[model samples]
Target: MNLNIKILNQKEINNMKISKKFTSIFLAGLLSASVAFSTPA
Candidate 1:
């Protein structure tokens, strides 16, 4: 039971880490895209 709880906690932590990484990447892409679009052609 304890081992299962530990594994679940680890999975949650890993998922949080992945989500943070994905958010950062998504934000960066959005920022770059906005800058490109806003630039005068």
Candidate 2:
């Protein structure tokens, strides 16, 4: 039971890391897109 809990915790940590990475990438893309739109062609 304890081992199972540890494994689940590890999975949660990995998921959080993945989500954070994706969020950062998404934010970066959004920032660039806004800047591109604001600038003259």
Best by TM-score: 2
Give candidate 2 regions above 4 Å deviation.
Answer: none
Expressed as tens digits, the lDDT of each residue in 1-41 for candidate 2 is 99999999999999999999999999999999999999999
Say which candidate scores most in lDDT: 2
| Model 1 steric clash pairs | none
Question: Where does candidate 1 have its weakest 10-residue lDDT segment?
Answer: 32-41
Candidate 1, residue 4: the lDDT equals 100
TM-score of each: 0.73, 0.75
lDDT by residue (tens digit), candidate 1, 1-41: 99999999999999999999999999999999999999988
lDDT for model 2: 1.00
lDDT of 2 at 20: 100
